[model samples]
Target: MGALMPAPQSKLIVRACVGAAKEAARGHTSRASKEGCANFEGLYQDSGGGVVEVSQTKCNIRARNAAQRWSMDANADGIQVFMWDVVGTLRDGFISWSNQATWVILQDAAEAEKKGLPFLPRRFHAVCGPGNVCILREEREQSCRTRAFASRSE
Candidate 1:
């Protein structure tokens, strides 16, 4: 007798994942679905040969604005990546800070000053002039730090 025919694979399964992260915060997390397959297909004309293969993948993502700080957990495999876009002006913007270094420095300085102790001075460049010149001054300061960070990566 002929051998029994094998079961046909289902062609309606789909895979998807969704994630959300706060603006200028650290350690982003994702939510996963409990019922979903990794592949999908629909009725359509064959491309060339008799058999056909189809697949569809989706990812739902949401993110907020970054005011003073931003952070996300890196994947172990280094495959997934994230990016964002800014909108509107600073007057309508919201802010969030995640890095602890800023707080640590402020706390240490406050304690030292209370005891009449000498503390190392921390300096930051700022725009003092008015009008369009202010924007140019801000850009110059940003470029300095950007160049330094990019060079280290190389």
Candidate 2:
């Protein structure tokens, strides 16, 4: 039997254009803790061990949990304009910008129609190609706090 190989980590970074919808921004990565217990000296301690619960409240739950959560939220919220711009370097000595997560964008658009949200500009157009320099522009404007909230599908 051959040894099992681990799945490769995604090289892509999925960034949302708009901000979170406000309700999702409050208490983000700010409120999180583990269960407590008494230690040898009868002092209060985290019984859950040193297992510090990372900010589980963040909208982005690492790469592992993002896709599933995003999909469910897309289905529920009926997202309107979800798009992706991919950037990759070519070994042929050229860089390129392409559509990577376009399928996810379509699914989100369909879900948006099902949920009754604005579904337009669902297509993604390339801005610039790969290189040492990459300048990006966002059509959807939002603050960090708002963006965080907007990104949340919940």
Candidate 3:
């Protein structure tokens, strides 16, 4: 009989952040030690991992439903004009701007409804600010405090 030959070996290298690399190295060392492997050699085995499947059609339908819900809510609040502007911004590929504008418009609409005042498109623009960045309430308060302290020091 002919002498048997050993299976060929291959190395797998992964590049990640420092934290992730350290975590992976720790797991590998633990597994190697548990299996009593010497110098982590000849211990490679392929475990069939399950694959995750996602349906693109379902994703699209969910996104459309969310948009319709937002539209209906805005219309009910008499703020469809502002919603249309947000839709236009989204269509123009300014995703971040659209998100901020939508959030500001919705918040204003809710506040106006609570106070029995109408939400104006002009108010939406003012709250959204230039470049469509909305300063959150916490951030606005922090800025005010900083300015007050600076004025007092001066």
Per-model TM-score versus the true fold: 0.14, 0.24, 0.17
- Candidate 3 global CA lDDT score: 0.19
Best by lDDT: 2
Residue pairs with clashing backbones, model 3: none
Per-residue lDDT, model 1, residue 22, is 12
Q: Rank the candidates by TM-score, best first.
A: 2, 3, 1
Candidate 1 vs candidate 3: the lDDT winner is: 3
lDDT of 3 by residue, 1-154 (tens): 1211111121112222221111111211122222232111111101111111111121121111221132122211111112344431111111112322211111122334466654322111112233322221211212221100000000
Error in Å for residue 96 of model 2: 16
Write model 1 residue lDDT over 1-154, tens digit each, in one string: 1211111211111111111101111111222222222111111111111111111233222221122233322111111222233111111011111110010011122234465654332221222122211100111122221100000000
lDDT of 1 at 107: 12
User: What lDDT would candidate 2 get against the real structure?
Assistant: 0.20
RMSD to the native, candidate 1?
A: 26.0
lDDT of 3 at 12: 19
Q: Against the true structure, whose TM-score is highest?
A: 2
- Residue-level error in angstroms, candidate 3, position 25: 43
Clashing pairs in 1: 24-69, 24-70
